[model samples]
Target: MVDPMKQFWVTVAAVFVALLIFVALPVVFLTGAMVSAVTSPSASGPSGPVVIELDLRGGVTDQAPQNPFAMFSGSGLSVMGIVDVLDRAQDDDDVRALFVRLPEAGMSPAAADEIRQAISRFRRAGKPVIAHSQGMMQSGAVVSSYMVGAAADEFWLQGNAALQAAGLQTEEIFFARAFERYGVEPQFEQRYEFKNAVNPFLQSDYTAAHREATLGWMNSVYLSAVANAARDRDMDRTVLQQALEAGPAMGEAARERGLVDRLGQVEEAEQRALTRAGEGAETISFASYAARPDTRRHRGPVIAVIEAEGPIVTGTGGSASPFGDASTIYSDRTAEAIYDAIEDEDVKAIVFRVSSPGGSDVASEQILAAVRAAVAAGKPVVVSMGAYAASGGYWISSEASHIVAQPTTLTGSIGVFGGKFVLSEALARFGVDIRSLSVGGETANLFSPADEFSAADRAAFSGWMDQIYDGFIQRVSRGRELPIERVREIARGRVWTGTEALRLGLVDELGGFHEAVQRAKVLAEIDEDADVQLRRFPAQQGFWEQLGLAFGGGAEAARALITLGALANDPDVQAAVREVQTARARAEGSHVLADEPL
Candidate 1:
């Protein structure tokens, strides 16, 4: 409607405006990326020289660290941080020795072993490691001290404190009676004579099978402690146990009992340690150590450390607790991550760092498939098992080119179980009358929102479980190079230590995470002199996490704050909880996680 010249001018103006907006968008994206890039790498480890202190608080769960890595959604001690510290300590000749101030709680046996391994490797350079604590040490901290204690020139404890190896005990929080009281019927199917995954939800007391299995593990843990303490003390295992039962050393009783080398505080302990190391106590706190590039000869090939932490679920919705609490739906997210690692070309070898207690069978299989893909890609996949890697954990590790586990790592539960709980009676009691109908079977969709599973459905579940059991046996046998019969004979959901697992042919080697990485290096024909840059495939943060950081990252930083970086949830307990929840919800209603059909 206007003049042609004016119209042309308007069009040109609009074009210029659009160009400017597009440029501005890219600049915003770039800015956010830069901030994220700067923040994430800096948050990994502290920024100083090495002085190590572990803030050991809370109940020890399967999860290693409980702090979230940025918005990476998981909890537990900073395992990567631990690894980094050990690596630094080992390489730094200036750093003479390590000191254990005091851990707050009793660490899990597995964590104790991890810490012990790190200390031992540090001491390989023929340096002293000292433990000086006023608080009474729990089994975890005490046992860890023992590993390096004998080698240390001196071991010191507070005058009033001593070792309290309470031995191992298992307590199942049974809500079975609770379920029955609430009018919910616990139902399940387990094929093996000893598959007891559903025991806590069904029985009021330990089944003979469950009792035997539990006792076996407890005995193993106890005996190991006895041997460790006795060997270091130059005494017999029986004598040590008798001493422990009598009572942990009180005052001079600890030194007299040989439970401790001396009764002293930090200053005296440091003096003794100095004598042992042929130098003054080189005091260092772990907090001061900064993240530096790994200067170790890289061996020319890069081994990608894909942290397979948290629950092996269907999708990643973690950060609650990576290892023990409910994190991801069983097996889903793990499979995706593994597949992604496999696709990265720069990754010459794969280090599947497992810290899971296992999860869904289907999910486990999916992860295995990704590992197989990596193998097919000419990348030899090696596994580094963390604390509890049993059941589905073993399922994935069984086929690795090599597997490394700590001597105290709990593993080797080659088992399968399925169950459900029906709440029909509870609903009826609540006066919520419900009815439903289905066409195909005697109790199709019985556990629908409007119905309860019929007797027929329960029977069908049991029958289906039998098939799954057979398939599980076959898979394990093939993976472990055992005959089907032998696999069945040992396929009860039973836990085992790394040492026991090695003997049972369940693990390739009794070693720490670095050992696995080294093996991968050898298998990949990496030259010993080549540079090895450690790469970690930590969890990628989510959209909201990015947005929040963008809005107030500087403000949060301005508070002059420091974050607790290392922490993870127990993956084992978390997966178990997820499994229970999935089964119970399925029994409650059919449509929530609809797998079959509406």
Candidate 2:
């Protein structure tokens, strides 16, 4: 009696809708899951071989990406991002090799050294490292490229490509010569010889001693790089030096110099990748891992990753400052965080993630002291270092029960450096003078707006730094169980790779954040299978931090955007930014002794 055709059409429509719900949704998710797994894949292959390609694109920094959507969350950079790739690649049993995609990073001489040494570690792991350079390198990127080239089982570059392995050079442009011609008189105050950060404003030609020191440091870095390259690549130092002097070598020139292991195109390189990594190299970019999973069924002891980044500063009178995460580093907030963590019985242990280049000394002491309190309260503390933890950074970590570092993490650089700028003359030339009057003996000792630091001022500043340096030596000495003499001998503000640091006793172990946490658990005597949850402190963002994000962005957020968008995407811009940032940070003012050191 009913229309049979109409009934059949309705049934067909229902079946189609059901198929959409069941088949379509899964297909979409699976595609994303797979996409996130491989940046580019060909044909069907196993979901294995995760090689962290180091386009080492930007000027390197301690902090990097932090995604709320990420399954493994951290308030700061995916500090473990590099490790995530490394662990998966090695553990998969299917992954046969690691393809290190290094590019010109436009970094400072010292920065390059850090990256190069990091690559050496993967090679030593028994896994093959294949380094390929599609572009040219000069400063930091070159150092990383050469380092990987040396460390890798094989290093390749395009046949037509040029390698601009420019030698190191540091030239300071003085404004005094130009300022004087404009009838400008500059004024400033006391500091050390090394405080010549403001030299350009005061002098025309470089100070002989200052120039010597700078040159000496640069030369030291250069020789170290050259020697390491020669040894790693099986080339002679003389040969390497010649190649460096003659920048941008191509084809046979590169081969003859032994800078590259082979001359090959991207296709040949991939074929090599397949041969070494076997059939599993497809998932090299897509897989991810973290120490703990998000979903937990039961309540249990938690091991939290507390990041201590940036300059340590004293509390702004219990005020919640904008800088809270380990990246921005406001010491008062950090102290408060530590204070809360020690009291929280749920936190079984603490793995303090430290990556800083020193800040305020007072802050450093406060943070370290808080950590000591936590240890006293029965919670063991382990320090996990990232790219760097020098000066005041070392101060806090020195007190940890144990420390861990990636071979490339710059860990040492003990000792303190503080200085001020006397830009009065430079400004006056521009018809702008900074006038200041002060009361009390040497009240304006730091930034005397009147004139350059008299010899007496320099002596005073130097003496103060001496005392702080001595304290730093003793603290590290005691914490590391070494003699003060030995600490001082190696504490001349020289940076070291995490591997070097371990040998020097600057760190206790060579691993990433996971190792630190695992060690913390072992030290804390927690059962391996005990349920754990990360306990966050200060449990809220301070007003200023929120405001900063409202206006510009939080430090971490800005850095993420900067690295991903601006820094990574543009090489020239990255270099300019690094030069400006480093220069400005050095010239503006200093917490050398770390106003908030830790």
Candidate 3:
């Protein structure tokens, strides 16, 4: 008879091998499938003249994730992807024309401008682009939507749809009164008056400085939008502005007023585009065409495009919201990307795309340091400002070799504010007791929610804000080569449009991503007309790599490991395993345990 202990050990070994195979096979198969899915092209080019169809109802993003799975899953169309695909389509012989539908309301002003620029280039290449609008509803940035439609070679509006692209309007809500009624105190300090981000908490209405700054930027944006649309439609700016200012009009009235070229259903507009494309023409979704692999390889100097989109934060990973997913500029990751570009011999320049409303001061500083390092390493760093690059956003871009902004991009707001909402009084009324215990000095509890800032705390916080503001001014002065006093005049926590910012010597160029790339080319001594390979830095992680990261460590992994260890050590588990093993061995006519019945 075989030694029972030896047989038991062999049985356990066999079960362990079987368990490994059970778990490992599926993982291997799944990984292979994922790899194949990600590597394979989403669409292959068809043999015909294709009218690229783009539907903007899903809205546009600044950039899409580099992951192929995400790209093909309708993650959403991105502005840069559209621009790049259009640029390619210009040279594509089979691409006869573009048929695009504008979003119902609007997209980001800067994003719309970029798409318009791309369309303009495609049109210059002797291709027709037709844009259709269901309606220019009165919603977010209606004028921007009209600007895009106006850029197309042919603009179409749905019959019976209203042209509500009147102008831009803003509504502000102040929480001071509400907080006062609720017995909650909002204690805050700002470097100066124009920094009105905290004004909602401090005042019942817009202060003189706040109103002045708000209107200044708003007027500039309004004029720029009208001017752009007027130019696109080949109409007199004054006449178009007057007509739009008169009021909303029906589709026919809009056509008569020269805002749109035709009034028809979307289908009719699409048929017109196809008819214009000549016989045997076909239509392809814009996403499908964009997913086609590019056969052309650029053998020029590499320009690393680093995206720092969303609020500047001091850690890894992005944040999610009900509105949508917003990619945060994690300091460590962003800085690492900059450093990688600086060290890469093939990369001659860096185009840092900044789209943020600002966040942590330390995080912004970390990214700024990397930018400076890139410049010092002889790599030209050019900043391409996105929708809104305010406060910390501007901070990181302050020292770039060149700064480019869209005409309506919001920049500046070079100020700092800090404070908290004290809920002690409000909670007390609700019979909710909140106590604070700290061992440090008076200002140690500066951010304690239960206590409002004392006079000393306020003084201390104000001084800190002043220091941050001064640093911001100094950096701007040094970067822009402006006098400190001049920087001071433009600072004061005031936000400025790219147009006004350009006028005040704040931004280097008023343009979009394409222009920023051209500036980078010029600075890197590369031929301005030559195409350069744009390598995106902080390259997207592979699926398996990401998977490993998810399960590798942290609190979850620790808990899982502990639970697994405990399960393995439990006596009941061991006994159950032994019984199962003995039964399986007996069925196979092999001994497992001596005490088991034979």
Candidate 4:
């Protein structure tokens, strides 16, 4: 028989040892890893002859994350940042060549165009740019892939990969018939016929105006893609179009058609690039090269770059989710950034970078006021559009001294729409009763989803919409220096490509972010060749603070609450959930720029 006291002591010792092994060891290991990561050298550039590797798989963003923690957690590369890297490499003697890995799912047409332009410049320096692709498919990806590939001095494709450039199309879902079957009524109104954002809920099919506008932009985009591709690939426009129509070509078929330069795997392509770069050549990632600190010290005037990305919402913008998806721009946060730039003595000008399809009208107006305030403070404001800047996007941009956009950019959806649906009938089917008591005047029940708009309510809503529409036209007229009549002619919720917008006087120039920066320099009276430090707005949080915020339980809990609230109130989600209710609004509806599909 064993002694009870001895056995108890031995058991206690064993448990203590297990705890040290299971808990303490992991804690120590994690601490050591964190320390090493923090202390690691920040130099990302290679020392000798390097072939810069550009990966186009993830698609580009307009701005890099400002927070260091977010960046460390693998943030997507910004288009401007990649362009800057290429510019630097063009002058870098150590960089012998450029290698590109094409994406399977294509990037945005505007983004691909910018990258193509950068590559063209790089090639002008007598350096080879080689692109290798696995495959390109799906809607919109084919054109994007071809555009980028055409910029390369040598384009290669995997033997099994297919070139599926089938052209462009737009799709919209209509819910009117379904709503009627469920006894839900959709009531909506818009300033004009061209503002068909609400038509999906009000009509079973495209109205004549809707079809006309959609076809207009779709054709414009397709033609532009073909022209650019033909010019880059040195192929006849007609021949290229026919090949695209008869696509899904593979291997030698693609090579024979001059669509690709060679058929091979990625390794074979890399070997070719290395051969052109000469002996002792190695590859370095574009991301790593971009992360290196600038060797030149910039003491010149500062040009602040404030990015207003995503839908414009009312409060302070939410932080990026843990998954790294971007969040919407909040009016308060954007206004704060504008004010910060204006108040800074070092910042001589502001470049407002906008990439949005538009959102809350009130939120847009608030941001516009901030822009006016910045100008009032004697700061020259310039707007640089990426992919989109329409409706509320244009609303905030109209007052800028100058606006720049890519030819492929979509802009100018100047319109307003509003209305709600009557969901009482739909609910009655489920035996749900909803009742409301109102003590205010006639318009108090105007927004109630259970009731349809009365004549008085309709008149009031129409008059309100007219007032907003009139203000929109006046702003555009004054800003663009065009007559009110001309502004009205193009303002009825019509969408336009950036090229068309420039011709119509809706935009000041056709170009990208670099052009905007150059314009800002001229406005600030700085020389074209002079060095100007580009500063980002809404300054990033400190390293320690970000570290805590990223890992702390507090932030996670708060994010959960905010997400729940967003799910309840998000306009997109609300529109989807209560389709009938959204259709019945008298004249109050979310006005979105129609370029999202493109």
Going through the candidates in order, what is the number of backbone clashes in each?
57, 21, 0, 11
Two-way lDDT contest, 1 vs 4, winner = 4
Using lDDT, rank the candidates from best to worst: 3, 4, 2, 1
Candidate 3, 102-204: lDDT as tens digits: 8878678888888888999999999898999988778768888889888998999998988887788788999999999999899888878998999999999
Q: Model 4 lDDT vs. the true structure?
A: 0.77
Point to the candidate with the largest TM-score.
Answer: 3
Q: How do the residues 26-90 of candidate 4 rate in per-residue lDDT, one tens digit apiece? A: 23223332221222343364577989899877667766654433543443677878877898889
Off by over 4 Å in 4: 1-39, 42-46, 65-75, 318-324, 542-544, 547-598
Candidate 1, residues 1-598, lDDT tens digits: the string is 7566764554454344334533343232233332222234432343333334333332323333323233233223455556657767677765655666545345556665666566667767666667765655454435443443443435576776655544554577777788888887766677564667788888888899888877776676557656765765577878767776665566587677766677887778766654554433344445434334446645455678776665566644432332234334235555666666677777778888787777777778887887777877888888888877887777777777778887777787777777666766878899976676678967678456554446787777777777766766776676678888887776677777787878887788877677887888788888655667666555544332322222233223212111211000123432443455457657987545532111
Candidate 2 per-residue C-alpha lDDT over 1-598 given as tens digits, one digit per residue, 9 for 90 to 100: 7466764554455344333433332232234332212222331234555443444433344544221222223322242445434543454455466665655544433334434444555556667777777757565435544654566788888888877776665577888877677555554332334435456788888887557556655555556667777888777889788877777888768878767878888668756866776554553342332222224424667775577666666664333432333345667767778888888778878888887877777888888888888888888889888657877788888888888876656666676666655567767767787777767777355556556776767777778878877777778988889988898777766666665677888888876665676788788897765655655565533322333232233354333332333222244543454455445556978433421101
TM-score of 2: 0.61
Best by lDDT: 3
Q: Give the TM-score of candidate 1.
A: 0.74
TM-score of every model? 0.74, 0.61, 0.84, 0.83
Better of 3 and 4 by lDDT: 3
How do these models rank on TM-score, best leading?
A: 3, 4, 1, 2
